[model samples]
Target chain A: MATVAAKAGEAGIVGAAERLGVPLLTYAAADLAQVAVPNPSAAPLAAVGTPSVAEAAALLGAPGGELVVQKRKSAMATVAVARRRPRGRLALVGLGPGARDLMTPRAVAELRRASVVVGLDQYVDQVRDLLAPGTRVLESGLGAEEERARSAVAQARAGHAVALIGSGDAGVYAMASPALAEAGDDIDVVGVPGVTAALAAAALLGAPLGHDHVSISLSDLHTPWDVIERRVRAAAESDLVVTFYNPRSRGRDWQLPKALSILAGHRAPATPVGVVHAASRPDERAEVTTLAALDVTTVDMVTVVTVGNTASREIAGRMVTPRGYRWQS
Target chain B: MATVAAKAGEAGIVGAAERLGVPLLTYAAADLAQVAVPNPSAAPLAAVGTPSVAEAAALLGAPGGELVVQKRKSAMATVAVARRRPRGRLALVGLGPGARDLMTPRAVAELRRASVVVGLDQYVDQVRDLLAPGTRVLESGLGAEEERARSAVAQARAGHAVALIGSGDAGVYAMASPALAEAGDDIDVVGVPGVTAALAAAALLGAPLGHDHVSISLSDLHTPWDVIERRVRAAAESDLVVTFYNPRSRGRDWQLPKALSILAGHRAPATPVGVVHAASRPDERAEVTTLAALDVTTVDMVTVVTVGNTASREIAGRMVTPRGYRWQS
Candidate 1:
């Protein structure tokens, strides 16, 4: 295995290899001191035998390999990307709820940086104005999530900078999962998280998420009802504020009612529940109700339902879960 | 209680009142039809025999009060803000996890909109350049969090737009709780959520938060250690990925170790743990290691520690928890 070594004191190198899907190779100061590198520093030369651990390791690992990227520095670490060939990039981006203002600057930059953007047709429409003038957009309809993930990875492997976009935090119940499953080490993958639906809904509903919370999808498309029910039960039993994504749709009405019933079993019927549909969007609709009064028919695929814990309070009209111990209240 | 009524079919009025910390008031068409308003519409008159629902409701509720804001139309609904008096505005803002790019545009807008800004001295320095010209900054040192919250609220009450900022999501273990606790319905309060520390750290560590997770603050300054321990125990027993905020400091080093031991009892020693210090800042440091191997000394108050659940895996050096049932993985 190709080995890489850094100053013994440096901590991220081991995890960096794990991120790059490579084995870490460590060398003693005296050993790395002997290897001549293309670029080196006096600090490392003074601390270790080698002037550059990253460059020296690459040279040592692949005797004839070329240094593709010179050392790039982050705040505390230096990364020297080395490969035998050119590499493409894949960025999994979250668009944040539906509002343009909710989108993180980094997510916007990634969308503009990518040569090709892949996402659901509706999501593409949501961010179409933010894309660079010449950017290519490949959009599909719903139920093609797997195909979109595959296409994004394939484009990345073909040396195109591709951004696979989703609404809300992409890593949370979004495209990051499917894309990561299809991705390999041949491409550089970056995940830019967006404001998730749970957080957005919580914000709209006051501070129901002031304390600990969990986000569970009630879609039951890929995840079974039993599994979703178990998670709901766990959250309910733990006094956890729960945010339900994909809470309901035309066909999925019963699932939400069932899940709410499961939660109702654990807490009082008067527990505050917030339902936000199309958060931050033009058609945004949000309301605070009780578990007993929450009408499941009002929810849809675009809605996020937050159920407060036993300690949560309906103050004025807003649902607030205080960040203090119940005893304090 | 004075009653204000809109069309009964309007779906968002109840939720809007809840968000505004007010009670929903309803009036029948005939009742509102009897009142006169500034802007009369034939449509509402024909449909419900009311000239305007919002204006009529405001006029009816506060019989002698003025309509402060004109009726505004959104895509799905019309809103007319009415108040007994001119109120100050308070926005609890999150600066994201140290990176300028991670900050949402709404957060930036809030900074620009605020006539006064309140935050920790260091945090103010981080985003001082982003503030609009003429904005007054009230910066304080650590241990004065309560003081800052009071100052922000006081400033807002004085009729100035105030932004109380904190790193990562302000709502998550930051200033939102304290400030909200100090606030009343007199002033308009808006919470602009940011990329929380846990989410930011999770992104740098790959998809460790792909599944459900809970964030717990290990700092004992405000919360008792027994409460923290019990919460940690609940997380461990629930098999949820736990993200520890305020994980460790020079004097508080023992809490993380003790909490990790509690987690170790429920999970294998090999469970992946991600530690990110000063995430997205110039001094940022991130690493992925097993619970058994994580060195507690490397963590400090600036770090966030995420311990994965039993199903989390170290793939290619990245920590990932699948969103599916155990059988699928």
Candidate 2:
């Protein structure tokens, strides 16, 4: 039980805490005055130098908690109750690769369950119809990933059920990482995995990822070029099938060619490479070509380039990598 | 237009091919007899030394194609048409982490659209209710992945829409690699990516995969232990986060420990390691422990073990790896 310093000595308030077998928490007028409450009145401010005694006291008593009941006035005193630990839910939802059908059922359900939805402007537009009528949408432009993560975490901290949506699997080069970095254990976090771009592109290219693989993002916006080069070299040396995400863009033109050249040092010129652009979307295009024959100009930001390992082959007009080294027909 | 050798010289058959502006390809009785036909008649066999002239001729005319029309007999003749390229769709669908909601809408829709669904008996049972009425299900016991893949391809070759289901993303250490190796360009293949076990486990354990990561299956059933070791060592040297799938089973016990030891060589002993069992399922369990403290006995085949990179940290009981190398709080 909680009460103001002056009310802590009252017989009725003391008896209620004793009967409930809980210690009475008393707050000073200065401490209560610092707390923000929904209901603030002149009566408490004039009498005890606080805008609200009951509401502020309730809030102050439950640290990092939320007010459950508003202030109610009685003949002798005012009362309010606060939940000691109010946990808000933050669901990081992945919408899959472009196509609506590719989105998982759980992702759609999370969108409806959330009272607040946050995502990039384009991703939010994709599932705008899925949200409930009263759900608040917090959307920003493409480069505002950190801002979106902050806003989602802040909303969740304020005790609102929030869903942060991203394209592809949230864990794979998407919003889940940034959002998780900003989020603490104060709120409940649920991760809804979606179909990542690499897998989506692999599907179109006749299972080029049938064997062990590694996914590397070519965009060096956050990561250094040397680190990216080292990872690509490691993948090449290991002979693991490589899936290159963010392979190329108008501004980032040289990375894809440079990365492919590293693989070429270890791989044969005839090595199979599958290039997929905008997989599963209406403008989706998938093509299988040899590493030497590939034209880098056709690649773009949305493209995913999968370079097959040494054992990978192009058979019957489709790229295929056998599951084992000693592959038998 | 196709016809039997005996009927090709006939004025009516020749005129019909001319009117249709197509070449009349005539097959001998022996050639026609070699081709299999669904509707075989004794009358055609006795008259031309072949089972059925129209049906066999149609099938032979379109190589690697399907018979769309059965033989229709009239008083004087029989007519049948074979689709030159009867494209049959083979959708390889990933069911996702043993949860109904984790399965994508496209996976469910493909199950309903398929006239034939082939998968392991257990995976087939997971979505048996989602299949449309009259859908033929060809399910086999475990260790029969090859047989299931063959059966699905055969069904698709015979001009039936087929769906092959697997748990988690089909491309990642699942049925897609084997199935695509067996498939040819004869069928239209569709890859439906699902929530891989690694991503699902990562989601439950916070954002351990906030950076570049690699998924390596520890089971040495098809892959050599040395090859797997090399990949693990490469991942460790590159400072990439690693997710171990097929970590352990009753028969295979040492692989998980060995893989972790490789990562421990490069990562700190206090690095966060997330162990998740049956993620997104009712029996889901997630734990974040340091490398030195993790108990390997608690892991099994259904479990996914993720080892964080050098930059990863445990904050408020959740494992998180910042998105950038030089992360500022």
State the lDDT at A191 in candidate 2. 86
Clashing pairs in model 2?
A: none
Scoring each candidate complex against the real one, what DockQ results? 0.28, 0.60
Report the poorest 10 consecutive residues by lDDT, candidate 2 chain A. Answer: A320-329
Q: Which stretches of candidate 1 lie over 4 Å from their true place?
A: A1-84, A326-328, B1-85, B326-328
Clashes of each: 8, 0
Quote the positional error of residue B34 for candidate 1 in Å.
30
**lDDT by residue for model 1 (A206-303), tens:** 77877777777887777567867767777877677888888887766788888898899989999999999988999988899999998888888889
Q: What C-alpha lDDT does candidate 2 achieve relative to the native structure?
A: 0.87
Identify the leading candidate in terms of TM-score: 2
- Model 1, residue A177: C-alpha shift (Å): 2.6
Error of 1 at B150 (Å): 2.9
What is the number of residue pairs that collide in model 1?
8
lDDT per residue as tens, model 1, B131-152: 9999999999987877998899
